[model samples]
Target: MTLLALKNISLRFGGPPLLDGVNFAIERGERVCLLGRNGEGKSTLMRIVTGQQQADDGDVMRSQGLRIAEMPQDVPKGLSGTVREVIASGGGKVGAALAEYHHLLHENPDDLDRLGSLQQILDTQNGWALDARIDALVAKLDLPADTDFNALSGGLKRRALLGRALALEPELLLLDEPTNHLDLDSIAWIENFLADWDGALLFITHDRSFLRRLATRIAELDRGQLTSWPGDYDNYLRRREERLHAEAQEVALFDKKLAQEEAWIRKGIEARRTRDMGRVKRLYEMREQYAQRRNLQGTAQFTVQDAERSGKLVAEAKNLSYAAGGKTIARNFSTTVLRGDKIGIIGPNGVGKTTLLRLLLGQLHADSGEVRTGSNLEIAWFDQLRSTLDERKTVWENIAGGKEYVELGGARKHVMSYLQEFLFTPDRARSPTHVLSGGERSRLLLAQLFSQPANLLVLDEPTNDLDVETLDLLEELIVDFAGTVLVVSHDRAFLNNVVMRTLAFEGDGRIGEYIGGYDDWLRQRPVATARPAAGTKPKPAAVPVVATAPASKSPLDSKQKRELAELPGKIEKLEAEQEALGLKLATLYASDPGKAVETQKALSAIEQTLATAYARWESLESLRDA
Candidate 1:
C-alpha cells in the first residue's frame, strides 16, 4: 500500500540547492506534515512531487496507475465557472468516465464492450450521485455552490479548491497551508474530515494544533535537507530536542578527543618512527572526521522592550453595543481591563473581535455605550491588514522614516543594522514593501512595534505567516511582557502559552469570558456541538471509576472552594498593579516626590513576582485538604 517514494531528490535553481538529496515516502493512511522555515523550498518540493515541476536529480516513484491530487498554496488562474462545476471538474475520474460513456454512445451505439467498461467506471465512481455529493460537501464547507469560483473570498476559494481535490478522491492528497484562512469552525471540520480520510495525506501548515491532532509523522526541511521523525507534533518536538542534544554531545566528544590526539602529535610523537607512526596516522584520520562535522544552528533571537508603567485601569467598556450592515456584532457588552492583563479575543471570522478592539481604543463610536481609558495608557497595535506599513516605501524607509540611523536602547544605530536584526538583508531593506513575503512583512511590523515599547499591546492575528521559530520568540515575549496584551490569534499553541484567559465571541453578539486558552475554551463549550458538524460525536466507551481512599478524597474544603472562587478576580486586579498604585503614587508625588519614585519602583518589581506567588498559593491551597 505504498503511495509514493521520492529518492535522492535534489532540486537547484541555478543558485543554492533548494532540496539536497532528500528521501521521502508516503504509505497508505499516513498523515505526514512537512515543516520548515519560510523560504525553505517546501512548496517547491510539493510541486516536484506532483510533476508540476521536476527535480534536477532523483526519482519520484508511484505504484502504477495511482491517482494524485494537489491543493497548492495559491489558487491557480483561468478557473472560470460556478463552484459546483469546479468541484465536478475536480472529480477527475467520475467526470472523465461520464464523458467517455456518453462519447462511446455517440460514436458507436453497437460498441457494447467500450460502453460496458465506461459504465462500470461511472457506476463504481458514483457518477450519477456526483451532483448531490458535491452539493452536500459545498454546503458543509459553507461555500456558495452557485457563486463563481473567482468571486469567492480568499478563504472560500481555498475551500472550493479543497472541495474539488477531495471530490477526486485520489490515492494521495498534497495540501499546503490548508488552515491559513480558515476560521475555528472550518478548521475543526477539516480536522474531523481528514481524520476519517483513508488516503495518504502530506501537507504544510503553521497550525500546531492541527499537526498535533492529525499528523502521524513530521518531516522538517531545513538548510536544503529533509529530516523526518515518526510521531505527532508534541512527540516530534521532544524527540527533535533529544536528537539535537545527542548530536551536540557527539560533536563535543569528537572535538575533545581530536584535540588530545593532535596535541600528542605536536609533541613530536610522529618523530618516534615505529612506535608513534600508527598513533600519528590515527590522529590525522580523527582530524578529518572532526573537521567535516556540522553543528546545529542557533535559534532566532527575539526581545521585547520593557514597557513604561501605566495606570491600573487600562480600559473598560460600559454597555458596549455595535452594529454594521444591519447586523449586530457586539450587543450590550461590558468588560474591564487592567494593566498586565493578557486577554485573547477569539470567535468565528467577522465576529467583531476587531470591532470590539476599535471600540476600546475609541476609534469607533459604540451605538449605546461608553469607553474609559487611563491617561497613561500607551497602545501598540498590530493590524491584521498591516495597514501601518506603506507598500511604496522600502523596508528601511518604512522603519526609519527617512533617517539613516535610529536610537535603540540609548544607542544610535544605522537603520540597516536594525533591519538586519530581523534577518533582512541589505538588498531586502531597499526593496519595496510589496515585494516582501508575508512572514517578512510580519517580522518588519514586529520589529517596528518592539522598537517602541507600549503599556498596552493589541495584536490581531499576530501569528499569521510567522515561522515556528518566530512564533516561539513571540510567545516568550508575551509571557515575559510587563504590559497588558489583548490579542486575536487562531494559533492554539500561541494562545495557550501567552493568554491566561480568553474572551470568546459566541454567535449573535454574545461575548463570554472563558478561563484559559483555545483548548480550554473548547472544553468549556457545549459538548460535541462546539464544532460545525452535528450528530458526529463518537459513542463514549464505558470505564470503571476507581475511588482513591474509598471515595474519602472529599470535595474541596470550604476554605479552599471559597479561595478558588475569589482567585480569578484577585489575580486580575493584582496583574493590574500600576493602576492599583496610581492613587498612592499621586499622593506621594505631592508629599514627597523622591519617595513617590521609590514607591513606583517597588510596585514594578513586585507585580510579576506577586502574580506567581498567588498562583503558587492557589495550587497549594487546592491540594491542602485533599
Candidate 2:
C-alpha cells in the first residue's frame, strides 16, 4: 500500500527553489534513506509529509487515517516529567491518564483512593492494555522509567525520543540523523530494531554502516531535485555515478550543437537575407534553457598542513592507571604508539575514551604508573564539542585568527581563498559561527584543525555531524597523513577504513590492544555472554594482541616516478588553457554571443582533464611518500 506520495512539490524561500517540482512516494514496509548535504531542506520535506508545513505548489497524497511520527534532528524542548510520562505523551489523552496513574502509584503507594480514581479512568478508557505495553516498551528499551527525561545523556535522550515516536504506533516513521550522537552499540541495536520494523520508514543519516544495514532504497535530494534509486546504498552509488556521467555527456553535446547554431545566427546579414526566423527563435529558447540550468555544488577540497616529523616514538604508556568519579577508566593499561601509526579507540559513550586520550597525552595525571611523551610532538586535537570554535566570531575570523593570510603547507594563502577550499562562500564565511548548521560547524572545525601544522592528531568523535563526502575526504586525508594519529570515534566504517590498530575499552578498566579496526577487534576480542540492551551497562572483557610495526616504504618504479615528475607541469598547462577559454567565453558573451558556447565547451573539457591529472598526481604522490 502507498502510505504517502508527493507530486510537483515546489518550495522556495529566496533565490532558487529548494524542492523544485519534486515527486516522491513511500509504500508499506519500505525503509528509505534520504541522502543530501546539509541545508538541503530535507526536514522541510518531512514537515510537508506530516502536514506540519505546506509546499508552495504541490499535492501531498496520503492514505486516509495515516499516522505519521517524526524523531526530529534535535530534541524538542519544554519536555518535563519521568521517561514514562514523556513516552506516554505519544498516546494522547489515554497516555496522559496512564502517566498520571503510574506517577501516583509510584509516588504515593499508600494513597489508595487517588490511585483507585486513576485506575478507574484507565479501565474506563480501555488503557490497561496500553499501560502494559508502555511498561514492556520501557523494559525493552532498558530505560529507567522513574528518571527525569531531562537528566538523560544525549544518546539516552535520543533513545527515549525514539521510544516516544514508537509509542504513537505510526504507520510511517521519520527519523532525521537518528545516529547523530549515538555510540556504536546503540547504533547497532537501533539498526537491528529497524530491520525488523513493520511499518514504512524514512530517515536521514550520515552513517554509511547504518544506511547499508537498514535502507532498502535510497532517495537523494540534489540540486533542487529528488531522485529515488531502487536498491541499496552501494547500488545507488554506482548508478548515480553513471547517471551523472551520462548527464554530463548529454549536456556537452547539447552545448556543442547550441554553439554551432549560435555561430550560424551570428552572421546577422546572411541569416536576415535567408529569412530563417525559426532558427533565431530556436536560439532564444536554447538561451533560456542554458540560463536556467543549475550547476552542481562544488566539492570541498582539503589539504592538511603538516608539521615537521616527530620522534620515531610518539607516546608510550606503561602500567597506566586512571580513575574519575570512582570509576576506573584505565587500570594498568599500557600501549606504545610509533610514527605513522593510526590508532582507533572504541568503547561505549561515557566510558572514558576521552579520558584515556588525555592520559596518553599527559594532559591528565595517572593514579599510578606513568606516560612518557615523545620529543617535539606538535599535536592537533579535533574536539567533539566544537569548543575550539568561538560562537560569537565569524567563520573566517575563527579560521584566520584575525590574520588576512593563513600559512598552508608553509605557503601564505589568502584567508578567504582558503575558506573557499572548504566550501564556505564569502557570505557564509562572514556569518557568525553560531548560525552554522551541524554539518557546517563540523566543516569549520575541520578547517580550523587543518589550518595549523601537526605531526600528531588526536580526534574525538570527529565524524559526528559530517556528511559522507566530507567524511570520505577526511578519511583520505588521514590515511595520507604522514604522521601518528590517535582518534576516538564510534563511526564503524571510519575506523575500519582509517585505523591500522584498535584499542578496545572493556569492563573493569581493561583496555585491549588489537590489530585493524572495529570489526577486527570484534573478531579477536573475547566473546561476551550477550550484547547489552539499550540503556544497560556493558561488561566487555579485554583481549590483547601485540601490534606489529608498519613496514618500510618501497621506492617508486621508474615509470611511476616519471609520471609523478611530469604531472605538475601538465596540470599547470591545463589550468592555463582552462583560464584562457573562460576569458574567451566571457569576451564572446559580451562582444559576440554566438561564439560563447563553443568557448564554454572547450573550458569544460579543460576542467575535466585538469581534474583527472590532479587526481593522478595525488595518487602517485601518496605512493612516492609511502
Using TM-score, give the best candidate's number: 2
Q: How accurate is candidate 1 locally (lDDT)?
A: 0.79
Question: Which regions of candidate 2 are displaced past 4 Å?
Answer: 106-120, 267-275, 529-626
- Let me know the TM-score candidate 1 reaches against the reference structure: 0.75
lDDT measured at residue 148 in model 1 versus the true structure, 0 to 100:
76
**Winning candidate number (lDDT):** 2
Candidate 1 regions with alpha-carbon error over 4 angstroms:
92-127, 250-297, 427-430, 526-626
For each candidate, what is the lDDT? Answer: 0.79, 0.85
lDDT of 2 by residue, 335-412 (tens): 999999999998877889999989888899999998998988999999999999999999999998788999888689
Candidate 1 clashing pairs? 312-579
lDDT of 1 by residue, 382-426 (tens): 988899999999999888899999776667889888877787878
TM-score of 2: 0.82
